[model samples]
Target: MLLQIDLQKEEPIYMQIVHQIIEGIAKNELKPGDDLPSVRSLGADIGINFHTVNKAYQILKQEGFILIHRQKGVVIHPDAAYLANAAYVEKLKRDIRPIIAEAAARNLPIREMEKLVETLYNEMKGE
Candidate 1:
C-alpha cells in the first residue's frame, strides 16, 4: 500500500497512517490476507520512527483491520467486514455528527451533503 504523510498536519503521524490504510482497504487497494510491510521497513520508507508505524499497526490490530503474526509479520484481517451493530452505529454517529453539523453551520444544504455522501460511497465501492 502507498501511504502519504504530511508532517505539517495537526493530526498525529500514526493517525495519518491509520487513516490511509483504512482508505486503502476501502478503495480495494489492499485485500484481505495481504501482507503489509514490516514496521521497520515501512518507517524507513516513510522517513518516520519505527515506533510510529508500530503504534499505527497496533491500533489497526485492535480495531480488527490487521493481524500480526510472529512468523508472517503483519497481514490484513481476513474477515474485516464492519459490523453495523448498535454500538458501532452509535460510534459512527458520534464521529460524523460534528462534521455534518459543521457543514450545516457553513450553510451547506442538506441535498448537497446527501450528494456528497452518495458520491463518497460510490467511490468507496469503486462504482
Candidate 2:
C-alpha cells in the first residue's frame, strides 16, 4: 500500500495513517485477507514511532476495519459487518453533521453539497 503523510498538516500522524488506510481499502488497493506491514516495519518505513502506527492499527481494529493476530499480524477484516453496523452509521452521522452544518451556515445549496458528496463517493469507488 502507498501512503503519503504530510508532517506539515494539522492532522496528527496517526490519523493520517488511519485515513490513508481507509482510503486504500475504499479504493480497492487493500482488500479482505490482505496482510498489512507490521507496526514496527511500517513505522520504520514512514519514519515515525512504532507507537503511532500501533495506535492507528488499534483504532482500525476497534472500528472493525482490520484484524490483528499474534502469528499472522494484521489483515483487513474479512466481513462487511462494519458497513451495516448501527453504531457505525451513528458515527458517520456525527462526523458528517459538522460539515453539513458548516455548509448550511455558509448558505451553500443543499443540492450542491449533495453533488459534492456524490463526487467524493464516486472518486473513492474509482468510478
Candidate 3:
C-alpha cells in the first residue's frame, strides 16, 4: 500500500494507517481476500514499532476493514462498511466537513476543489 505518514500531524499513527488503508479500499487498490503484511512486518517496513502497527491492525479489524486469521495474517474486505452504517457515514461527513470549511475559509473555490478531485480520481484510475 502507498502511504505517507506525517509525524508532525496531530493524528495518531494508527489512525493514519487506518485512514490510508480505508482509502486504498475505496480506490479499489486493495480488494477482498487480499492478504496484508503482518503487523510486525509492516512496522519493520515502515520503520515503526511493531506495537504501533498492531494497534492499527486491531482498529481495522474492529472496524471490519480486515479480518484477522490465525497464522494467515490480515486480509482486507472487498467493500467498505462505512456506507452501510449511518454512524460511519456521519463520522465521515464530520471528518470531511472541517477540511471543506477550511478550504472555503482560505478562499479556495469549490470549482478548484472539484477539478483537483477529478484530476486525482483520474490519476488513481490511470485514465
TM-scores, each model vs. reference: 0.94, 0.94, 0.75
Name the regions of candidate 3 deviating beyond 4 angstroms.
2-11, 78-85, 121-127
CA lDDT, candidate 3, residue 93: 94
Q: Which candidate model has the greater TM-score, 1 or 3?
A: 1
Error of 2 at 84 (Å): 2.5
Q: Sort by lDDT, best first: what order?
A: 1, 2, 3
lDDT of 3 by residue, 1-127 (tens): 7678889899998899998987788677888889999888898888889899899999988888998888877899655444567887788799789889999999999999999879987876557
What lDDT tens digits, residue by residue, belong to model 1 across residues 18-89? 999988898999999999999999999999999999999999999899999999999999976676689878
Itemize residue pairs with steric clashes in candidate 1. none
lDDT top scorer = 1
Whole-model lDDT, model 1: 0.94
State the C-alpha lDDT per candidate. 0.94, 0.91, 0.84
The Cα RMSD in angstroms, rounded to one decimal, for candidate 2 relative to the true structure is 1.2
**Which of the two, 1 or 3, has more lDDT?**
1
